[model samples]
Target: MIEQGYNFGYLDENTKRMIRRALLKAVALPGYQVPFGSREMPLPYGWGTGGIQLTASVIGPDDTLKVIDQGADDTTNAVSIRRFFHRVTGVATTERTAEATIIQTRHRVPEATLGEHQILVYQVPMPEPLFRLEPRVAETRRMHALADYGLMHVKLYEDIARHGAVTTSYNYPVMVNQRYLMSPSPIPAFDNPKLDRMPALQLFGAGREKRLYAVPPYTPVRSLDFEDHPFVPVRADAACVICGSRASYLDELIVDDGGTRHFVCSDTDYCASRPPLQEDAA
Candidate 1:
């Protein structure tokens, strides 16, 4: 009953309609972060209100929905979002990456290959790629409109000047279609390759920031890095502790309060779904 008078999911349809309209424009422009009137969801602000709105706009009777956070379908927040869709629209849900037609994700893209018919919706805390360097929303809008990204280049150059490389490890910015710079949400830089020329469509939603953006399937996406110092997506040197896999992003976990920790693949689905190296071992 989030949309009822008791809750209203923290925003009404009029605001959602505004966001929906902006999303259409973003799809048309491809990489342009269109400004919209974002609405609040019953969930926390940093959560997935933007994803919820985008889902509401496009979800139809025939679509199969998937929701993931940190790449695990069972994460509480992801499960909550899946249930929210069930409550609102009663769509079927799946954890299997192959079965989903629309995947709403946070922090990681599914390792499974997404088909051209699928749509990947990212829950974005911030859609502006230049936002960290320049905090003012108004200023960034001007930058996108004019394609003035020299500030971003200078910042990257400054990182090389001091740190010997681009210091950013995740949520790295990329140029979309040689036009607008967009944030790939907080997906590890490992996922950057997936964004490039993918068969599936990619969309970003930032509710708190009031923006929505897109990268058309098979569109170009390049991370900000220099020819001398290229970008790298970090992974654990070791395999997943539970379901051993070397190809997925790992979450470094602390076993004790002392902070002694070991790294494991953050994308549990990817970890679990990989073909076992040795069938006899299983």
Candidate 2:
């Protein structure tokens, strides 16, 4: 029996059906945004309502859900979402990346390699890649319909012309399946390559805008770049002080008043899973 004051999966049957239909269409046309009836979630629009809605639609009793914000599971927003799901649907919640069946993320992808069994749902504030160039919704729709991405190319080229290289660091636009241009959320460029031919199914939901999109497992995702200047993922040269991982994304923390700072893995789960630093080293 479902819990009181909440429908199964925290969403009503009718809303779930509508979202499921939209998801099916999104998966069928990979990288294409499918508009749906975005119901007003309890959470605010910019506070991961899209991801929560998507999760509510797809989650099952058998599914293990994980929620993360800026790569940390213990953050207030992440914890609230996880607890909300547990309260509503009574589904198991996990912090481990590999153990999760579905993960709702805000800014960063997990440091661990996701497998085919996992589904990643990203909370997207903006899904239209060409919106900045042309604000008109109708004009942007027409541009996408015609596969006209010249404005994006020109913008990148101008960045190269001014700065020796493309300066776009986050929310790097990607060409999915060699057709549609998709935004991979606000994840840094370092995580951009991870989206290419990844084993996990990726879904993007924009609640305020009432749109959702998908990238099927093993689909090709190439970052937009000029022929002469290729796309390069940038990261700090320093290693994480806590986990000693150089590859994982690092967060700078000021430790002392003397301006002593340390870089640590932004992924709490990733850092916790690593071997502890030696006492002698500490």
Full-model lDDT for every candidate? 0.82, 0.91
Candidate 1 residues lying further than 4 Å off, grouped into runs, are 1-17, 256-260, 275-282
lDDT of 2 by residue, 49-118 (tens): 8888899998989999999999999999999999999889999999999899999999899999999899
Top model number, TM-score: 2
Q: Give a tens-digit lDDT track for model 1, residues 100-161.
A: 99999988888887899999999999888887789998898899899999999999899889
Specify the poorest-scoring 10-residue window by lDDT in model 1.
Answer: 1-10
Candidate 1 residue 64 Cα shift, in angstroms, is: 1.3
- RMSD (Å) of each candidate, 1 decimal: 3.0, 1.4
lDDT leader: 2
